[model samples]
Target: MEKFTTLTGVAAPLPIVNVDTDMIIPKQFLKTIKRTGLGASLFYEQRFNEDGSENEDFILNKPAYRNAKILVAGDNFGCGSSREHAPWALQDFGITCVISTSFADIFYNNCFKNGILPIVVSPEELEKLMDDASRGSNATLTVDLEAEEIRGPDGGRIPFKIDAFRRHCLLNGLDDIGLTMQKSEAIQGYEGRMSENRPWV
Candidate 1:
């Protein structure tokens, strides 16, 4: 996982609510367990037609949002199945942060593990951000994790709250395995003592 201190880039507006994991990567693309290639298939169903051609109508296919680093979506984003691949696909698609009024619990936590920031904001605040993102190529937003603030293109600032421990982990690039590694010495010592005291086993 990568450290997520701050980010500044274009934000794609996705106002669809109840965006489930399947809608994100689709079931066909889940054949591979690897994370990198999924970006090309992110939102596969919506992004492509039955003939396997690009859909010009989808928000992501638009030239301005093709490289968007942040997403401003509608309420209850990432709902449905608890798939870790949802965040993986988002990260692979170059989305470092997602701002929505609310998110599914499992998907929200998975985002943090995969080095993606999932932000929960008020409905009124989301409207403001969505309006900013509607500017297409000019929809640049800045997210400062340390400061817990989001700055819009016109210099409007919004504050958000997150769990202190999750904030620390994201700042330092610590995942579950990374957290366990922090106590390696203690684990080693315990193993050594067990071996010495139980020689027969």
Candidate 2:
């Protein structure tokens, strides 16, 4: 996981709601446990046609949004099956944040774990960001985790709430494994004492 202190990047507008795990990673691409390559297949069914060609109509295929690091989507984003791969693909595709009116609980939690900021705000605020994102490459948004705000290109700032613990983890780049590693010395000492006291084992 990477440290996510602040990000200022292109914001792609995805107006669709209920973007499920299947549309995100797809079933066929689930065979591999790796996370990197999935970016190419993100939104597999919607991004590419049956002939494996880019679907020009999709927001991601547009030239301006091809390098989008953020997405402004409709309500109920990331609904459906509980697949961690959804966040993996989003992160792999360089999306550091997703702003929506609402998001599925599981997917929202998963975003924090994967270094992605899933922001939920009022529908009015979301629409404003969506409008800003419609301006193509100029749809620049600044997400400052420390400030807990999303700044738009039109000089508007919207505040968002995030768990303090999750904010700490993302700021320092600490995942579950990274959290455990913080106590490595204590763990090593415990193991040494156990070995010394129980030689037979």
Candidate 3:
């Protein structure tokens, strides 16, 4: 996982609601455990046609949003199955931050672990962000985790809240493995003592 202190980039407007995990990376792409290469298949169905041609209508396929790093989406942004691949695909596609009116619990938790920021805002706030994202190439939003503020292209700011522990983990680039490593010395000491006391086992 990477540290996510701050990020400023193009905001892609995905106004559709109930965007499930499968809709994100699709079920076929889930066979591979590797997080890489899923970026190409992110939103596979919506981004491609029946013949595998790029869909011009999808927000991600548009030239302006092709490299978008922020996504302003509708409500229930990550519903359905609890697939970790959804966040992996989003992060692989360069979307470090996602702003939505609401999100599924599992998906929201997975975003932090994968170094992606999933923001929940009021419906009114989402409307504002969506309008800002509609500005084509000029749709830029700055997400400052430390400040808990989202700065829009026109210099407007929207505040958000997140769990303090999750914020700390993201700031320090600490995933579950990283968190465990922080106590390596204590774990090593415990194992040493166990071996000394129970050598017969």
Question: CA lDDT of each candidate?
Answer: 0.93, 0.92, 0.94
lDDT of 2 at 65: 96
Query: Distance (Å) between predicted and true CA of 114, model 1?
Result: 1.2
Which structure among the candidates has the greatest lDDT? 3
lDDT of 1 by residue, 73-127 (tens): 9899999988888899999999989999999999999998989999999999999
- Order of all candidates by TM-score, from best down to worst? 3, 2, 1
**Colliding residue pairs in candidate 3:** none
- Which ranges of candidate 3 are over 4 A from the true structure? none
lDDT of 3 at 107: 97
What is the C-alpha local distance difference test score of candidate 2?
0.92
- Model 3, span 1-201: residue lDDT tens: 799999999999999999999999899999999989899999999999999999999999999999999999989999999999999999999998999989999999999999999999999999999999999886688999999999998999999999999999999999999999999999999999999999987
RMSD of each: 1.1, 0.9, 0.8
Better of 1 and 2 by TM-score: 2
Q: Name the candidate, 1 or 3, with the larger TM-score value.
A: 3
